[model samples]
Target: MSNINVDEVEEQMEEDEFEEELHETIRFLLVEFRGSLYTFTKHIANMNCERVHRPLNRRPITSRGYNYIHKILKEDPTNFREIYRMYPDVFLKLNNILREKTHLQDTRYICIEEMLAVFLLVVGHNTRYCLIRKTFERSRYNTSQNFNKVLKALNSIAADMMVKPGSAVPEKIRESTRFYPYFKDCIGAIDGTHIPATVFGRDTNSYRNRHGKISQNVLAACNFDLEFIYVLSGWEGSAHDSNVLTDALSRNNGLKVTQGYFFNATSLFNFFLFFRIIYSIHYCGVRYHLQDFTGQGRHPEDAKELFNLRHTSLRNVTERLFGIFKSRFKLFKTAPPFKYTTQTEIVLACAGLHNFLRKECRSDEFPVETEIEVPPSSSEQVYKDDNFGELFDTQEQQRTNTNAWRDAIANQMWSDYDHIVNKS
Candidate 1:
């Protein structure tokens, strides 16, 4: 018993010594070298015995934290060359939040550079763990395990940094609202987007609600500045946007707004008054309409010709919300090749990181393009009064459904719009 106790003490002391040595070594290295590709390679070779003899590339630098900075420069070469230059005050702000000595032990990927790199990957590429691993080969960690750890760590950190604990808005944002009155009463804008996934036959109908595919319903709430405030990304894709909102409202403690309202589309209803509805028209001609249900007649607003004309057009926050999110992260913009579980996590991580960068940016200039292809000619016909009423009546309907939430709420807000339209 005595010998065993002695050995245990010795092992603990050795661990402490090893930790101290590692820290000292990293500090020494930081002081010793300038961040050139050749110098970085030589430094890593000396410090990490596991690194192989491949010429240093983007991946290795990613592990070391230089590439995220490099990427910032590459993207905006005309504006800035150094990461520190673009975000001069960021390190100081981060240091105040992330105390240096606390997260320094037993973490290969905890450094500021690595965290930012992980954030960039999730939002910029939204790539898989395996692909990220291949991209940063110098990481001496299992791809999946490290990826999950990074995500978990980021969730806690970002939530702490960006989420205003007990309040839905972040501190900087709540304070900034004085200058930007659009954000004054607004806590966030809510919406749902579909993430594609594979479906099993047994679970086909469960995942195939009204949307027509196997997908996870991704629900997000962004502030007026378009930074994500809350993200709930794992509901079945077939789930209605209302259902997703219901889940998110119930899940997170901070998101439940007991007092105020937010903005969303008409798909969400009166139970959650937190949203100001964005009105849209869905026309189906009575004859060509393949749907089982009969039209109540033309919308009263259609008859009065006032639904589009009378109301003060509030900001289309939801449209801009989808545009900004998908624009920054291509993963959510297009259908992914991955199956469900992986797809959900990727989306969640991207949302979390979006909040992080939006907080970090000194300038809100999002890069205009990412080489993503857009249709040169939109095939969607504009709804003009002349033929629009006749046009939609001809379309086929695979599913005839009304969101229960929407039906319940429509009368409360748009009662005037409802009274004017005529029925079929």
Candidate 2:
């Protein structure tokens, strides 16, 4: 065998081994190529499937979304303080109120807390439904239904939430040095604000105010504590405060005015006629004193000026009340795009909520939250003759009687005030 070409035998064996290795390499390469092609096909199929089966509006909150909610509304006590400032019992009592009143049942997807979160986002943030729908993973219909449902529930509770000044309020005025005898009988201050609103029709002009925007002239009365005692909204923005007051008063058991009480008034209403209409309700408003009398004009020359200054000062409660209301709800800050009727209901709802918060929270005033900074104010009102002009005495007799009563109160204020000059 050794002599039979052993070297040749070794060389042939080496060639065969090389051929086997080449075949193995080709087989490996083919397997790898087929595997890569299969992967590519699967990727393309996934893309096509995604396009065909799109996402639905009603879906669960993604993991990231759940994380965000937890971040804002913490599980522990550390961050809940911030939440309480928006309104105490926001998470606790609000859900109860809604659940008790609203017929909406909680499903596997939506819960009471989720629905309230959506409502508050609209009120506190003035967020659009579409944006909230996206965040909560709720259908647009779901968002709208819950929002209006809560709004209706809030409206239903407005009257109950209102703080009536009639209950032991005059005593507060009687004891106050800022008001004293002049406003001793005063229940509150009355004024009208232009809240921007939108409407469609021939009556649209009626909804537009002097600012040339559509709004409602909302009449509200507030007391020393800066609580709204009464609210009369839904009048055409063009409606005068005096006219609105008349309508409210003329209704059966309407805005009942106590005899001998007074309301610090402003130029927005006809003070002279208002007194005659309510007959028993006295009118005490800021008087125009042309005299820069003492030259400094800081000091009042007569009782009327003093009364006017005091009236302006005390009546400022209503202004502060409005600031609180507007600042709290974004819906009020911006022009609300609802029908005139809905606009009225929104006003009442907000006012009721305001009173409810004030009574419930018992804070000096609504803390200006940095979350809502300088919301836009809407304007809507139209100038027209007051509807109640002829309802009361146009005669000078009641006018004279009102002037005499007001003068008596002013004189009493002047006499009562301790005057002393700091002379050196």
Off by over 4 Å in 1: 1-112, 115-119, 128-135, 139-141, 161-188, 198-201, 209-211, 252-254, 258-267, 271-312, 334-342, 367-424
> How far out, in Å, is residue 359 in model 2?
1.9
lDDT of 2 by residue, 55-76 (tens): 4743543333334454566565
Model-by-model lDDT, in order?
0.48, 0.65
Per-residue CA lDDT of candidate 1, range 176-259, in tens?
A: 422123233345556566656656668867766353556677777665566666777777755656556666666645354434
* lDDT, candidate 1, at 158: 56
Task: Write down the lDDT that model 1 would get.
Answer: 0.48
> Against the hidden reference, what TM-scores do the models get?
0.50, 0.71
User: For candidate 2, what is the TM-score?
Assistant: 0.71
